[model samples]
Target: MKKLIKKNIVIATHEYATGFPQHLRSYLSDHSSGNVLYIHHPLHPELREGIGSGYEWNSGKKRISSRSTRPVTAFGIAFFMKSLFLDIWWTLKSGKRWDAYIGVNNLNALAGVVLQKFGMVKKSIYYTVDFIPHRFSNTFLNAMYLWIDKLCVKQCDETWILSPRIREGRHRVLHIPSSYDRKQIEVPEGIWLSRIKQAPFSSVSPHTGVFVGVLLERMGLQLVLQAMPKILKKIPDFRLIVIGKGAYEHELKRLITQLGIQKSVECKGYVEKFSDVEKIVARCAVGFAPYTTEKSGLTYFADPAKTKTYLGCSVPVVMTNMFHNACDIE
Candidate 1:
């Protein structure tokens, strides 16, 4: 057995959501028996500000509803600058040499690369948390990200990834395939049973599936809406209850009406608690992930928090092959 190195650690990543970081934190909180330091770049307040159940997809409830300045051109610059300042401030104040500085997101990794320059932090590990090159919001952003990605792999001492596809693509990226360990998610038995007992079943039908996650573009909510009518025809009671909100929620609602599945589907936007999702998932017979091939860059390369949450709740899932480690269904 390889002896694990016990040391002080700093985990840098994006803010909380019903996404990767939330699940990662659930696991890493007790990881390796070492003191864990969490450092995050300031995320939009609209994205945070909720607890259990309310965040289980869109619950049709508005949580925080505050908008932040989303500057496209200067996003990277601003994010890097702010995160760099926070990181340096935290590390200096701690006055301790970090045994390992792990980046849970690409930008955070880049910040670590910046920290490694002072020649004090040892073993800066970059986690290729999502598919970057293919998921950039714009062309220029994509170009800049590609360069930053190169720096992360080239400049960091170790790199960690969640998928074989990403690892294979970045063969020169000098990283270990640490596919975001999935063994740590544990909902307390009392809470789990209570949520399951409290779950509200849909009268629509049994063939319908529920999708619970942030309603983002790359996640393929559009495809789910597009496929709803077809799925309804073939599988009656095949409604989709979308839980969560994002940049594409309004357009998705429009598409829902345009597709005429308004009665069949519900857009429960932004529940303030995850316990709501717990109930929603508990009642759901099947979890849906209709991520399309071309738009599946991030979905294909990263470990989805939704999939784990679904399985954790004993709900079988239907996800695309775009996701890695997806089990073969009978």
Candidate 2:
């Protein structure tokens, strides 16, 4: 039998509405035992008011003490600079050298590579949670993003991708060669039910459809909402449920009102618990993920969590194949 070895791992990443870093933190705690350091960066620095420090550090149940930064009021370029500074500064002061530094996005991953230069980490893992050819509308910004992506790919000891299709993008689009190891795609773990409980609702109809996750326009939920009228005509009492909220909420509500299909649609804006989401999806007939393939969107290359969530519930998904892990889901 092979002897099991343990190593301390450090994870540096931003926290978005999706709560990806939190999920990852939980997963690591449950699966591994070395001294794991999780650094939480500000999601929106521009919104964080006046000298407040959004940068935080945690290892298991213990919190590391650090002074907060006067968050930059300006977003975009300024925010990127802030994120880079925080990533390096905190890791440098974290007291112990990490065996592996896992950075979730390209920017954070680039920070890990830099730390490897300063001898702070033995291995730097560029863990890409999302990928897209044209991530920014601005040509220069998009080019810069790709440049950093490639830099991280080459500098990091290993690149941990969520989907294999990301390799295709790296080769054909970003031009990274195939010689690099193509293993280590962390397929999301299976769900472990905390408690056997039904969704708060009475009973969901078989004709009902559900969409869950951060409500982004790129998700293509509008397409389903626009077509709900035609769907109701044929299927009778066919209803569609929107189970999250985002910047698109107002637009969704406006369109629902305009289409006069308000009666057939239920917008259940952001249910807080994962168990609640699980229960709701399990009872639904189908899950919608009609991603907007017309343009460059993060979902095109990221292994979407909702797809797994739906399948976990035994609910079939209706999604775009442009996604990186779409084939696996199929």
Candidate 3:
């Protein structure tokens, strides 16, 4: 008889509701043969289930949970208890008997290390998309996050980092740089690649610029807005189309009006389909990744999805010097 693969794998991630986990799972499912279970808390179980796909990561709860912003609030306590219980449950359920396990992100990696305490599994891989503890918080929080990351690095058999900068201080740890997914990284199969080969987004004027990605504060929207007047002075027809949405949408819009550049700046908001992203990017001549400089270690190791998407579409980019993933282009 031909040898049969009997490994039971678990994929732990926080991106159960997003495309990151979906794409990663799709790749894993194609390559591996065994029982592969995804552990995640589905915030929108109803909608996810209605889609008739196993992509749902619901914790079997009818009501979705939220975190309170107050200092030492009851909601914070409840949230931790709930999250801890879920983690313990998954650990016990997937531990011991499984042949291999993989965890994505720092939080999930910590959970995998904890699961190893049960003395069941031998191989556990930790994959980090970016530096976590330094991403959004202040000094104290960053220190605490670094402590947790140390524990994860010490426990895992192999660690996959997304950027070279992240491998510092942990040289002995087994590290792999996660490359852009080949399947999702391919150019569109149609006239666009040919058009790009000919003139590269002929629909857009040579001066027009476009940015696609989550419109969050860390992305340095303020800098891009500040740079607008400078760019406009050089190129009169210079226009910027902002895609994606977040907390600062209205504030950014107001800043455009304050700067009196409303006509030249357009905030197109969030997009649902990959094709929509391709279409929006196809209408621009230049792409921009204007991440701000901060002490945050997270920004130093970012592999912005927008960076790869723009490159795949054959659009040239102007990115921050501090951005790690776009160094080749820089």
Candidate 4:
């Protein structure tokens, strides 16, 4: 038997201890022999205790959670700049030469480019999980984000996209010639290793549905609220469990109140633990991922994590037709 050699890897991401990056960190820690340095954002006071505070390093697992000490609005330009600088500084100051540098978003991808350019990293991989151009409200910001995104895709050794639609858009629509290879890796919201073990808990109730993702207007949550009355007419006890928070939260709450379905709807806000999310999904009869068809809509050209999480927990999913893989569900 031959022992596999470990490769040194560094990951730069803005999301701190959540989503695909967290899953990737766990995977690398368990699989690799070399140390994995995860550069993440600062934690909130609640998340600052027990495995959340400071750096968490196991026998071979090492992570560096760094960012601006001052409070900044989440996903704002200031936050992005602060996170970028911290990641760049730590990546350079680590002293250890990384075999592979992986960046999870646009800002981190730019940092990865700098690391590669400066010879600090042998190879750079851009893990583009979302399209950022449509995320910005300002035109100049959107244009700037697109430019940086293109540069990262063109210069990185490998580009890993979350969906096939994004790849098509990059090649045929965008016509951005990539100097490197591109791969589509669909990273689900939460990993489910033992579906059978969890299946027994996934009891279906026709009157209940679950929506487990960011509560954004682009997510077509309004449509869900609009249809709630119709759903209630058919199933009087129809309940909607919303298990995430975002910019559209206030609007969603107002709509729920206006529609008089507030009693039937339960907003769980944000669940930090993936296990807790799965447990909630398991009890629901169906899952909702009603992404819109707008140009900025994520489902128009991406694999939604909520859809996968629903199916992973053996709950039937109700999503829009725009989702590329939605037809395959039946």
Candidate 3 residues lying further than 4 Å off, grouped into runs, are: 1-7, 16-20, 29-32, 41-81, 91-96, 119-122, 132-143, 169-207, 233-237
Q: Which ten residues in a row have the lowest lDDT in candidate 1?
A: 51-60
In the range 1-330, model 1's lDDT, one tens digit per residue, is: 012224556677655454444544444443445444556554544554431111111111212222233322333566556665666556555556676777766677876776677654676887766654455678787777777776676677776666655665544332423342231121211123333443444532366578887777777878878887888888866667788878778789889889888988877876766767866776777887767675336776666667766766667788776666665431
Which of the predicted structures, 1 or 2, would earn the higher lDDT when compared with the native?
2
Question: In model 4, which regions exceed 4 Å deviation?
Answer: 1-5, 42-75, 178-190, 195-204
Give the better candidate number (1 or 4) by lDDT: 4
- Best by TM-score, which number? 4
**Candidate lDDT values, in order:** 0.60, 0.74, 0.58, 0.71
The backbone clash count of each candidate, in order, is 24, 1, 0, 0
lDDT (tens digit, per residue) of candidate 3 on 123-172: 67677666643344577756655766666766777676666556642342
| TM-score sort, best first | 4, 2, 1, 3
- Residue 173 error for model 3, in Å? 15
Supply the global lDDT for candidate 4: 0.71
TM-scores of the models, in the given order?
0.71, 0.83, 0.69, 0.85
Runs in model 2 deviating more than 4 A are 1-6, 18-20, 42-74, 181-205, 234-236, 324-328
**Winner of 1 and 3 under TM-score:** 1
Give every collision pair in model 3. none
